[model samples]
Target: MFICPYCARNFYRAPKFRAVSHIRFLNASPNSPAIDVYLNDRLMFRNLLYKYFSDYVTIPSGTYHIKVFPSGNTVNPLIDKSLFIPPEKIFTLAAINEYPNMDLLSIEDVRHPKIPDKAFIRFGHLSPEAPTLNVVLPNGNTLFSNVSYKQITPYIPVDPGTYTIEARSSSSDERILYVPNIRLRGDRFYTIYAVGNLSKPPELQVLIPLDGNSYIGS
Candidate 1:
């Protein structure tokens, strides 16, 4: 004769009630392989290890329905999750937030330049791996390559005066955007800005104003 819900035992000879656990990774799924432990839906423990499945459950104190799955893959099959066992307590779960590699390249604007232009060079990058965009010419000779995130260059023919344009980065956390030294007038009209590795760095703006003043016929 035996009964024990919480010390309601009529045990003629008692000694059998066990439940213990300890899981400390705190942030799972580095690349899941095996994890499944359930009870009351039946199928308790299958390939478990925070480091040794806690020696075969016996969690007695009331309240057990722990489920976790993702363990068997020829391709994929086995996925579920649940946990709550308070009796001789020892459970920890905290880990989820992974996905920040990086990719956001952009350089959109630079169409048909050939008319008194003094400054108009804009390029962008955040990630494309094999990336290179070097355009330097005060008269040292250098024009770059592997470029195609949205390439455009129509007025890089400087020789009217005032110039200092430099956009350089070959990859791995690259960012460039500088403006405030341009005056290579011929037909007149200018704009220069560079910034893109996700955002926030491209603001030297001036779509056409070397200070000649205009509302375009006003």
Candidate 2:
């Protein structure tokens, strides 16, 4: 904090802060083998298995080319996507669909919260072969309705606690996936991602993960 001698004016370089974005990867392709994720040809996630999420990583904000492949192989990549990352955003890039027919689904996670005492959660439907669904409680109370494949709902605020959540077919009201003991802490954000097939092995399941905005600092 020094004033210029000649001009008698205060002039201090505040600081140089590079803009950045936070990102993580989620493997939701039930039939796919453990995978590798690349950003601009550089490996970001290695051997990420189904329903698993990588820890968040920070990067300079800009456009990036993303590719996903079976672990240890770069040839014949499974996915190729072009994405633009704005500064200070948090995201999860989910690898979805069965093997040999997969795509990347980018999910924007929560940022700052307007409510401090409430927890927030969203439903992300990633099952390629499932029907339009309703996110509900065990007692037939619906939270998100008519969500189809690759559809992600907006954040819903609720009391901070562990609870049972369900996914049911929107038409028949029959239960599809039962998620138990999902714990939501106050001031945090979460996404309950429904993945896999409704009629086959790797049967329907949900992966609930805390969003990066809950802890990652800008």
Candidate 3:
């Protein structure tokens, strides 16, 4: 049995003859127009909003052409790109806008067996206005440094406890964002996303959590 953290849906694997791949779509652009997604010129989703993501879709491993367009109009694609999917891997394709600029980011989601009495966590930098960031603990321990926009870190193990996670600019020690009182549980997996544009009103800076599903393992 496998579960998807994005939608909290469960799935059971069946026997297959060929390799397969899983991919999901995410809209990370704040205040941008809602969009549509297409693969191989076929519409896959419509009206996906900022900070919203879709469930994983499994397909045969191969190369694919992907396109994104504003909702209700397919004549002009905002992004067009080709991607290759290796067998038996999971990936997330994200659409991001830093106002006057729009781009796509592809992230591979990897999972492994949980260590006993410990939790695994990873971080993603999605804030466009922010510089490369350093993820630090309250004790000034750096977990990830020079993490740039659209970048994601590999999972790191830590003991289950309450923590205050902070992000600092790579060029300076000033804290850019701080998330306090995060409670992690043993044997669980989590991904923390740093989202929002620094220039936007309300500043769109936030830490979003996705509790990982343990049934999916490498």
Candidate 4:
């Protein structure tokens, strides 16, 4: 008795759920070990590496204890905390910083006020070594500025077309990444993540995209 907007398919039975929410995990720590995510003492995600983002998983809305441990080890947890999830919402949980100084940043993902014939996007700063950044368009307009590590911006709408996105250092105007010819389709949503460590051999930063429709019930 429900229709899937992404697939445009109708289902005879209502999707299983009473109160539900979606959650995605992002590993932003540059030097942290591969991690395992647990919900209520049960393993939920295994072997999530640095700079990786996991697809959204649906869960019933409630308060749950969350734990992050080194892969394959449960005796020691890098993070042990409890979080509350409200019904029919989306969230992104990011693990950040080096061990012993590690932390979690919980971001509420809001989808609303969409513009017709436009694409929506948000940017996340995950590169530990990178300085505060500025996201600029070819026309010299800035979309996001002074975004530091572990910072995430609110969604912005743009006309559906090809664009050359430039990431620059906010302090000195130094160019970091030039992502050219990126196309945004109408009515689509996206998250662009700045990834990589500045001290690493590949000094160049990388941008990774997570399509909005990756969540099943979104």
Candidate 4 vs. true structure, TM-score = 0.81
Model 2 poorest ten-residue lDDT run = 1-10
Candidate 3 CA-lDDT value: 0.75
For candidate 3, the per-residue lDDT at 134 reads 94
After superposing candidate 4, which stretches have Cα over 4 Å from the reference? 1-18, 201-204, 211-218
Candidate 1 local Cα displacement, residue 164, angstroms: 17
Best by TM-score: 2
Better of 2 and 4 by TM-score: 2
Tell me how far the alpha carbon of residue 6 in candidate 2 is from the true structure, in angstroms, after superposition. Answer: 56
Q: Which stretches of candidate 3 lie above 4 Å from their native place?
A: 1-5, 10-15, 207-213
- Candidate 2 regions with alpha-carbon error over 4 angstroms: 1-17
Q: TM-score per candidate, in order?
A: 0.17, 0.88, 0.85, 0.81
lDDT of 3 by residue, 1-218 (tens): 11123454333342488787777777777666888998899887779877777766666788889888888888868888898889878777888766326688888777677799998888888877788999999998998899988889998999999888888989987887888877778877777777786666536455444543444442
- lDDT of predicted model 1: 0.33
Local distance difference test, each candidate: 0.33, 0.80, 0.75, 0.73
Can you write out model 1's per-residue Cα lDDT over 81-177, one digit (the tens) per residue?
3445444432323222111221111121223434443433332222222235554544546544344433434434445566654544545324343
Scanning candidate 1 in windows of ten residues, the lowest lDDT window is 1-10
Those runs of model 1 whose alpha carbons end farther than 4 Å from true positions after fitting are: 1-117, 131-133, 136-218
Pairs of residues clashing in candidate 1:
18-58, 19-58, 19-59, 26-94, 27-95, 115-187, 116-186, 116-187, 118-184
Error of 1 at 174 (Å): 18
